[model samples]
Target: MNNKLKLSNEHTLARVLEIKHYTKALFSFKTTRPNNFKFKPGEFVMIGLIIKGEFIFRAYSICSSTWDNVLEFYSIKVPNGPFTSFLQKITTDSSIIIKTKSTGTLVLNALTLGKRLFLLCTGTGIAPFISIISEPGTYIKYNEVILVLTCRYSQELQYFNYKVKQMLKQPYIKLYARNKLRLYLSTTKGSYPYSGRITWLIKSGMLIADLKAYNFNRMDKFMICGSQQMILDVVNLLRSIGYLEGAINNPQDFVYERAFVS
Candidate 1:
């Protein structure tokens, strides 16, 4: 009998290191990164498990920094989801398939020069921003880094709240991230202190007023990720205000990635 793990040329096996369940429907996991795996901070890669000799994969944005030894991902558990149903059952003893290639429009190279960098996201959309802010270069590139995260419930905001605190305490980027990095959280449901969708906040000028910053201008760069509807709304709003969508080959004022909404 042969008990060797077999993967395609584009995939590799990675060992699960840790898993944390934030809520019944939301969880995060860490895995040992392959030495050869290379990716930008805001990129995502396909990950999955081999079930019954069939590979089932899903695109998950990486939540860890490029310099980190391990790779982390934030995920939402869809009831009976083809890949997530089995992923939620994984343990530290299990191994998952990781595709080596990573790609996304949220990378730093996609944006032109800007003074303030705004990372707008909702729910698990916060995943890529985690990696983006964790990179030391992010602070150096912009004078201010603002992260606006919105969720349906306050409980969904806990993970990022904790992560932001930790980033402020990390020695390597502590000084750079101290006052430069700011976090704004909101909940669409419940009576949370800040309650509203990000689109509403921006449209009403409350987002800038709350931050006590200047109004949206060409000097500001935006990276937006979230549900399809949220992305569309934000993109439309930005476009109306003269913000151009950026790409790898064409750097512009803003970039957006449609996160895995399921």
Candidate 2:
């Protein structure tokens, strides 16, 4: 093993605390965070492992809340993927590499004050929103927080449903957000409580009706994370209704980040 190809040990060794396989293709894992590791709830950081003296890494959203003791991540195991292939084989106490810096456009700071915050996501894109909804800022900033998740199968929704139910049981979360938080789990290829693309549901006005939300007022803000296609389609949908893109420096109506680069 060449020392030149090895990762540095200064601020980035994350020991795996636990791993949960949600499905054949999806999983979630928690790791020991460095005492100095700091990040907003909805940001992403480079997570990796040293393989045969080579450092291989990818950007992963932190699925755990900032207040949580350990860092958590939700991921998709691409069968032959260079990174995930090795990642999925890890067991308890395995050491993983994490880059010190974390950043993303999905944080609540990227959007201005609003009465309602809509988190639109698909598949693993739901990772960041999980952190967002778990944070105290989400409940304080908006009267309501809506999580809209669309996947191809109903079973894929299990992880989120379980987490939400667990969060609901937390005394503080339930007290502040029991009625304010909402989850809309939908599937496109499987029979579920809600079926069809979120774009269509938004266009058909069924989403608002289901929530019985006040008319899409100017105070509504949106944060979108998903495939490029899903993000683009939803952008068009929001724009058609007078929404605008936002950023940290110039917070506007909505913000978005690509779920995966490929």
Best by lDDT: 1
lDDT of each: 0.89, 0.85
What is the TM-score (0 to 1) of candidate 1?
Answer: 0.95
Off by over 4 Å in 2: 9-11, 258-262
**lDDT by residue for model 1 over 138-247, one digit each (tens)?**
99999999999999999998788877787768899787788898888899999887878998999888888888988887899999998888988899999999999999
Error of 1 at 55 (Å): 0.5
Per-residue lDDT over 24-50 for candidate 2, one digit per residue giving the tens place of the 0 to 100 score: 998888899888788987899998887
As for candidate 2, its clashing pairs are none
Model 1: colliding residue pairs: none
